[model samples]
Target: MPAPSPLRAALLAARANLAPGLVLQGFAAAIVAGYYLAPPVRTALERLAVFRGEVGLPFAVVSTGIFGAVIPFVILRLSAATRNRYTLAQMSALVAFWAYKGVEISLFYALQARVFGEEQTVFTIVAKTLVDQFVYGPTLAAPLTWLVYAWVELRFDTRALIADLRAPGLYRERIFPLLVTSWSVWLPTVVIIYLLPTALQLPLQNIVCCFFTLLIIFMTRRPTGAV
Candidate 1:
């Protein structure tokens, strides 16, 4: 049998990811529904903004690191093999990667909010979602995160990481698929995130990020042969 092409492998990966993607989307959808239909949830989400304002960028960096990296690692902590590979250095890298992402997304969302204004109109939401999923995400967010995570996967081995990048069509083999999966999952979720008040945007992003981190960790746990 011919080996899987990059696109094919990516599709299979995305298919395999549907369960976690759906779960994350459902969680985000529930949050959106709650914000619209439940007063308590709205209040709680708003409070996150208040806290974010108090701490500035550190709020996002710390929250993203915790929800995105720390918690997922803890979930798989029971596996001795898993625990063995990831020590302080690996953990720190993961934290720093996630923290950077948190900072990026927070600033991105804030900029979008400023550009698009804090209106809840359909046009406003659509504009931000379009730029988020199609523009900023594909161009910057997805590819960058995939590369950073790839380094983490190789335990931060610089030479090995360079070889992987130097492989023919790294974009097709790795990044394109990641972007495909990210668009598949985050497209709708980004819309839900943009539908909220400015202060709550980063907070909601962090919440959805929690599930996303869990999904990524789940994927990484799969057998190398299976992937």
Candidate 2:
């Protein structure tokens, strides 16, 4: 068989790392959103499985399963080369990280509720608003976080990532081409996550929170070529 193109290999590795983390982060956001919705998707999942009564596991599982499947499918559809060297071991590690987040989020909310009681009153609302301005501000920064992570990852693994950037004949390696190829799919999805509230008449805060969780994935992932 012909050897796998270096660009293809690099991109696949990047995607594989990003994909699972994104799904997990997305799942965390979903749990927060489900809190406001009538359905309570998170609690439902907790009730059904090992995650029973757990805070974020249910939502995490649902979000990860759905987005995890969809993003990879979209990537495969867009680039046949994405289906390269994506090992099961890597996928398992991704899922494990996701589960850790689920547990963490659950513990946090649980602790807050137990210590402070439910946050449905006016005073609590005001306090949360104040916290939002400082302590929780990073949670609102999703787009910037993802972009920075992608850039850093690319730089760290520049050699491995763009090994094929130079062909025997081609002299210049245009970064824009590589970026556009990857972001063509990711950018739209990011935009859609933010836009869902406005388009679907859902709560904007929830959408924002969901995107924030997605951002965390990008922030926390172990950069392959940590520059």
Candidate 3:
């Protein structure tokens, strides 16, 4: 049997993810709508930002870690299909990695706000979103995420990691599919995230990340009667 080309594999992955991606898109849109249309939603989000202001970056790190990694790990464990897929060590590693990512994203967003301007105008939001999804996401975040997952898949073995790095097209094959799915899912979502104030962008991202992770987890559930 022939293996799929990278492009073919990427497209297939994207196709499989289209349903969950749209659900995430809709869910984000609804949140934005509710934020504007419902006073309570706006008030609640503002309270979050105020508390973040009070407690500082540690709050962001912890909350992002919880939402971006820990909650997903817990939920995945609860799902019968994937319950046994990840070991405790891998889960701990994921938490640490995503906790770092939370800090990375916060700094990146701050940098974007400074470079691209913090105003929520269409031009500002579009520019920041483009730079985020294209430049930062592809160049920095996506590659690091790929590396982290690859290492985790290899069970934290250094020798195996070196061997895996030597494979031709390794980065392309591993990252291309991730890029495709990421652009599809997060491009619009980050635009939504950018529409909010700088203080709230990270919180919104944490929420969106949590929701998207759960979506992917459940989407991978086994069919009925599976062993």
Candidate 1 on 32-139: residue-level lDDT in tens? 889889999978877777887999999889988988788767865777766664677877888889898889988898899899888999999999999998899778
Tell me which residue pairs clash in candidate 2. 46-52
lDDT of 2: 0.40
User: Model 3 over residues 1-227: C-alpha lDDT tens digits?
Assistant: 99888778767777887787788778777877878899999999889889988988787789888997799888777879778867999778878887888888888889999998889899999899889988888788877777777677666877867876787897677677777767777988898888888888898788778866554333333345532
Q: Report the error of model 1 at residue 5, Å.
A: 1.9
Which ten residues in a row are the worst by lDDT in model 3?
218-227
lDDT of each: 0.78, 0.40, 0.78
Q: How close is candidate 2 to the true structure, as a TM-score?
A: 0.35
List candidate 2 segments past 4 Å from native.
Answer: 1-51, 54-87, 129-133, 136-227
Candidate 1 vs 3: which has more TM-score: 3
What's the CA RMSD of model 2 in angstroms? 12.5
Among residues 3 or more apart in sequence or in different chains, the pairs in candidate 3 whose N, CA or C atoms overlap within 3 Å are none
Q: For candidate 2, lDDT tens digit of each residue in 1-227?
A: 88445456436544654655466446545654674564666455334433343433555544443343334334444656545323444444434443444444344444544554453555544443344333432342222333333333353355643553343522112232233233423343333333222112112223333433333333334436543
Per-residue lDDT of 166 in model 1:
89
